[model samples]
Target: MTWHVFIKELKDSIRDRKTIFLSVLLPILFNVGLLFFLENVMMNEKVEQVTVAVDSNTDPVVISWLQELKELEVELVEDPVKVVKDGDALVAFIADADFITKLEKNEIPSISVFADPTSTKGGTTQDLISNVLTIKKQEYIAQRLADNNIDPLTIEPFQINIESISEGDDMSLYMISIFAQLIIVLAVLMGGLPAANDLFAGEKERKTMEALLMTPVNRFHIIVGKWMTISALSMLSGIFSCITFIIGVNLFTERLADALQLDKNIGFFTVSLLVGIIFFALLISSIQMIISLLANNLKEAQNYISPITTLAMVPYFVLIGVSVTELNSTHFMIPFLNIYALIKQLIYGIYDVTSILLVVGSSVVFIIITFVIAYAMFMKSKWVLGKS
Candidate 1:
């Protein structure tokens, strides 16, 4: 009987274009659009040129070198410091009046840089100038060493050589892991929403609740059937969204794909991630169903239920700054945060069986507790009919 109810509800949900669009198609489009926008617009854009004010008294050779660099545009000014303070340039360069004489005498000369420390452009300009000066200093040292008949290599100590055995780009894995986990969690809430709202609240608003109750089916069986339907749709939404996101990443962004790590442990990570999503799906489904059952009508249900997606995201934001290494087995016992922690583990290819087990065990306990509350609510005639 529960199977029959499940099949009927599933068919009805599949037939609703709105439901299908909300649950599956929207997530696919969102993932693809997000990847396209990030790849072409956000990530690929480059900083072209930074302007700086240089004092007229500065050395002509230094001024010419700065002007020759493709990334800098130098402006000669009498008061470089005043130009920078007045926001005329991103940075300013000034040197002591006898700077050239000091260099000829092999004596160190003072230099001053001025810029707004809080400005991003100023910071970038400062970094560029600093790098150029560093290279010039090294050249000056080499010339002095040659003049004294000393080998440049004699000044350097032993160098350290580093070799990495890791497979993927750390930056790419970090970005993909965050994007994938967020999409999956949001998909679960969205996918189950339409069915949960329509199953109970829509029926009440349409005056069909009485007909459903008149059937000889057990109330507990009805709740189970409806819960299973929501869970199945939620799982479908999450799985399809994840698939579309991966494919979108592969097809639209070759830069990320080339750096992606594909190894033996990928199988374990994928399976564990899927299992974690499934457990979360079941938990979210029961909770949504309970919210739906309590609402007087579809509008009230929507008003009450829509905030859940935003509420679900709070944990993601909280855990964003925390590193995976800082988390212990106790962290996996948490609800929304455990999924994030699991993704962090996958990012670094760390498979902690204890954390995985705790996630599964805690999820099961929450699922049972929520389903029991939903069952209790369903058994009450007043809640079932939304009267009191």
Candidate 2:
């Protein structure tokens, strides 16, 4: 019976230590342990003070004010522009001789902030210096007004209040997007590989293929049963990885919940997510099985599958290279890349029917092609009996 074959294959796969570790343990290690370690290190480390380069023409009082601020460190350099250009300083201040006198005169003076536009460090340093200068100017105005026997509030006629309408941090979508991609690649590949090799090459190598061929059951039933078994394992691996990521986020990143939108959405995955995940898992499993069936032995199968396994991670690289907004119709045709884009958009709470239909339809077409190819290869007596 097809059910019996499915059950037998599933049990055999479940008993393998390699399947257990690859499907379950490795995903946890990849998603939870690795992400936590990297993020924690970045978040907890002490930030170094911003080093600002300034020339002698800069006002001593302004320099003193900068040095007194805990966020900054003032470094005097002969040529501040050259220092900034050399990357020794994040920002450089070029001022004329009468910098303080101009401020006292309540006259605005030109002071250049030299920074590398391409560098985040340079931009951050420039912003901090600008903020400090702005506050200091306001203080100077207040003092001048008091000395002139006028009210400081005269200049500040009205105040504007800012109201924000958007919800939790945007990085939430980016984070969850990355997590889903890893789950698909790691889980589907890891869980399906051993089953694929063992079911095909291992059975052939052990001389069991001949006996299975003599059975009354149709070959279609056998292949379907085996495919189902492999697909089940693949689905489980992806689910386990997803669950591990969720738990890890809760335990390790509770502080980031507000910013990650976890506090609002709380439950990230829905029914559609599971359906999409399972659909991709089945697709990936079939590809693995096809590769496994091509080789004469387990070792050969592994050698062939290794490169594909590496290539299966193309989605992650694709995500890094392209922004979600830039993705178009053709991009949805790339095997794992489409799934990656879909999963990311799904996490961001996007549910456009066109994207869903594109991936689903493409998957159906590819699966049919691979299945027909695999079935044809499998039906050959020499190939099935390991004579080829």
Candidate 3:
């Protein structure tokens, strides 16, 4: 409440190496490490090469179709079964020599694909073969329709284009949701324990808390001052980490643009992201402050905060496991859930005013509750004077 105390606390925080490290250095390291690791794992990994063996008596059409998948190496072998058994090929295709003749005569032709199901390449090879076979089957069906003087497209009456119409028209909304959720979790993890430590155990250990209580300052002012100090540090860490993430996203966006289906041209997304960051910072800071007030010492505070941080992360993981459209009002009211939902909406360019209001309102409510609890804790003689 007092500018002097606030300024003094800020100076102390800046001078505290532990606080500075947690608030700044740690977040930078975490963001860089995470981005580098993900980039290496996702972008640098080589595409697996598959080998397919076709029987000598296989139909020319099928053989040609196999060849079309040039990315996959195809070889003609005298015995398809032997090729598969000898491990010389990952997959073998055996087709009836008269398969094309039968198809021409309006008869169905069958082909057998063989591989060791337990083999390392089995799943990959099977998927490749299935994709090729599916295309061939579609082609055969289309040809049959054409032969009967019918249009295959007409038979499949309507084609539905499921376009996601978020406000910003960016498909990266889903990925942005995930990143937002992670940011919240990271904020809690980095700040929660240290904030708790400073407010409870640090005060107790310093022996300065009791002397402050004897001063003319209200217990509420003391609590608010301490709370503000820890929350400021926590918010600083959150903001730094978020800024790092945004920068990393911009740098990584080009590479992941196709995979994430992002519309990189949408600049308005930055505005929404900034708004979300403000709300998220306030929300987590308030929550951590309340948790810190509840603990009698640093160790106890950590024990209390750890589970809450984990609980906050649960909704994010749950959302990840489900579809975006499945998000509803219940999720909007949930703490971390609401943050992620709003972020997803923003990323997709769907900035719903009502959703933003709900998130802001909920955060305010939590902040009020946190302050109320902290006020009550501060009023206690033992907590204020640090006697017990």
Candidate 4:
């Protein structure tokens, strides 16, 4: 009877193509589209060149250096400050009248830089100018040391070497992991909502629950079957979300390769991640089903279930500051935080069997608790029928 109910509900769910599309496909499209847009924005930022305005009195050496830089286009202007204020360039450099004399006397010369620090292009322009000036200062110091018959290398007491022993140099992997986990969590909740509401609340509103109860089946079995149907839909949504997210990440892998370390344990990582998502789906499905059974109508059920997403998101924000290294077995024992922490661990290629077990165990316990509550509700005539 339980199997029969599950199949019936699932078949009914499949017939609602609009619900499936809204619950599953919409999230995939939104997330993947956002990913592509971010990729383009970052690529544009990387190759963007800034124009620099230089006063006529600027030294020829400085002008030549700026022109040689691939990131800068130098334009000699009568008034560099005016050009910058007029938005003709991101930044301007003006040389003092005695700049050449100061250089000959081995004294510091004044160079005025005009820019709007509030803008991104202006910030980049400032950074480029600072870097060039630093290099020139180092060169001047080396020349001065040579003229004084001193070894320039002696100015530094010790040589420093930097070695990166980690697989990746940047935090891009961490960022991607957070995004993927959030999407999966949302997918699981949203995917089952329509079916959950329709199975119980919709049936009640449509006057079908009484007929379903009339069948010679155990009330617990009937509820279990409905729970399975909702879980299946949630799992489907989560799986498709995972696939879409993975494809989006792969599309930008080469572009982000230098900043992100590719995980070599992808097979194990994927299996574990899907396991976490599946278990979470089961847990959320049971909860949503209970809510559906309690509501008098589909609209009421939706109102009750809507806050579940926000409740799920609150943990994400709360645990956002918690790093993967800081995660312990205790953290995995928690419900929502466990799956979140688990995803973070998997992204960094840490597959601790203990952590996985903790997450699974916690989810199973919650599922059983919710299942019991749902079964109890189903057995009662008042709750099932939403009576006063």
Candidate 5:
């Protein structure tokens, strides 16, 4: 009898094009569009090239040095500082009049680099010019030593090396963590909403509720079957969301794929992730279904669910700026945030048995609680009979 109700509900949902679109096509389009926009933003944020203006009377070494640096354009100007001030150049170098003579005479000569410190582009260009000046100074010192019949290598200096003891240098986990919360939340809301509306308000509006109630099957079976159907449909959306993310990360962004640190044979891990998604979907669907059951009609349910959808995303946005190390066991008790933390841990390759057990145990407890609440709403005789 339960299977019959479940099959009937599943068939009805399949016939509804809105359910299919929300569960499948919507996630694909949204994920692709967001990734494309982000890729463009990352690409466009780069400093393409810097233009450095030098005074015509500047030493030849500095001019040659600036020209040799990659992605730099060197221009000889009558007044380098004026060129920079007039916005014709990012930065300008004004050399001392005694430039080469001072170097040859072993005297420290000062040159002025003109730039606006407040501007990002100007500041970046100035830094590049400053590095070039440092390198040129080192070259001048070497040349002076060679001219005096001394080995330039005799100047002693200690070498420093940097080696990281942690995992590889992929930082896209931060982006993936935020995106996981967003897509999973959206999948639950969008996928379950249509079905939730139909389960109560649609039946009430279409005048089909009395016939279903007249059937000999127990109310518990009817409610349980419908709840399973709603959870299944929501899980479909989660599947679509996961597919979209995997494809986008692996194909569109190598950095993100590396950050995820996935195993080549990810079958077991994938199954576990899908299981987590399904349980989360079950909880969200029950709440939405309960809300829909209380509303008088589909329009009322829509009005109610809109605010809930926004409320659902609040935790994700709050945690978007937060780091992994900052999160602790307390975060595991929050609704949406718990799932976020779980998925983040999975992505970063942290799979403590106790952690998974805690998340699954908490989820099962919430699922049972929500199911009881939704069933109570479903069994309301007055609401079911249109008396209220």
Candidate 6:
């Protein structure tokens, strides 16, 4: 391909407002906007007040336990059951007057926690009460163990230490995976349309494609030049998107680190992230070019390429559905699936060279197929000349 022709195409692309918007401005705005909204949501705790009704016979220990959580507003009242049933309280605790007597007799005292599970605050209040009750029960167990001259640790016999084997095991990585998936979907949706429109229908509409085909340059060279330009533009958008995302992540680093339960060095994932972005961009761009080349007009091209964009997004939902599923070579060879899986692994700091190789290999193969098809379309007299 002539450098002059490539430069001309690049300049033309730079002048296209739609190209600039898709390739740079839109990705940046989307990343920043999404992060800002999520940060605000994460920082704000929505709990207003928790109302808990207590029966007349409720134990002092239970009442005190409920009252101790200053963040929660607990109200003690007669007829706790009635209050809960009437929707006057978010939760109700009913303790029998004989609870202490039953405990002394070594009988499990049954206490019913009543709450409307469907109510807004009911679930939260119920969970809070359950946690408090569990602690009280554990305390009672420890006391019982002490009374019997037994150590609680000996009775438990074994201590289990749960350790996460995944690298970057934090909330940030999880959130990043979600953001990455969204970026892929957005890149395809926004970039696919214009790339298809410009290469296929736009050329037809402009009537310049016919004259260009009359030149002595080989069809393969012409297609390669155009493909490189479109791919570069798409890749530019993808890179910008990743940069914006990293910036947003850095902005909320303190809060996100806490929320994600991450160490200070989560930013190290940036390298692998950019690698994934470039790979994904190339794959989607090639697919868009092929789809666009198949269309007869802008409207027809959009109709054809729209489904491809949706197809590109299918793996995102599929990956979410099967996130816990084991990874294998079969899974690694699939196009979008490999990217999503590798991204998850990358975020978690699990680097499997074999999987990466497979993904890269599959991508290269697909890229080759796309170029071959694109060249065939470029060589077709009617299609290249816009006579059909």
Candidate 6 displacement at residue 355 in angstroms: 4.7
Q: How close is candidate 2 to the true structure, as a TM-score?
A: 0.71
Q: Which candidate leads in TM-score?
A: 1
Alpha carbon lDDT of residue 210, candidate 4? 92
Model 3 lDDT on a 0 to 1 scale: 0.69
lDDT of candidate 5 over 153-241, digit per residue (tens) = 68846667897544764345666666766776687668878988888888887778889999999999998888888888888898888
**Rank by lDDT (best first):** 1, 4, 5, 2, 6, 3
Per-candidate Cα lDDT values, in order, are 0.82, 0.76, 0.69, 0.81, 0.78, 0.71
Runs off by more than 4 Å, candidate 3? 32-47, 50-67, 70-128, 141-173, 205-208, 251-275, 321-332, 381-387
Please give the range of 10 consecutive residues that has the lowest summed lDDT in model 3.
Answer: 165-174
RMSD of each: 4.2, 5.7, 5.2, 4.1, 5.6, 4.8
Best by lDDT: 1
Give model 2 RMSD, 1 decimal.
5.7
| TM-score on alpha carbons, each prediction | 0.79, 0.71, 0.72, 0.78, 0.71, 0.74
Q: How far in Å is the alpha carbon of 167 misplaced in model 6? A: 7.3
| Candidate 4 lDDT by residue in tens digits, 1-388 | 8899899888999899976795678878967875675556643457567888888877787777778788888888899888988998989988766676788798889877779989888987888888888898888889889999999879989999997555663456656666767887888888888899999899888888998899898887788888999999988888888777767777655544343344566688779989998999899988888898899998999898778768878878866787778888877988888888888787777889989999999999999998889888888877787752
lDDT of 2 by residue, 199-274 (tens): 9888888888878878998998898888889889888888887677667766777434444444455444544556
Candidate 6 residue-wise lDDT, 150-237, digit = tens: 9999778787999875554345556666666677547644653576578766787677677777889776777667766776777777
Error of 5 at 338 (Å): 1.3
Shift of residue 256 alpha carbon in model 1, Å: 1.7
* lDDT of each residue in 195-296, candidate 1, tens digit only: 999998888888888898899998877888888899999998988887787678778896566655434465786788788879989999999988998898
lDDT string for model 3 (105-199, tens) is 88888988888889867767777878988988888899889888997888798888987544442324444556656864476457534754775
Better of 3 and 4 by TM-score: 4
Which is better, 4 or 5, measured by lDDT? 4
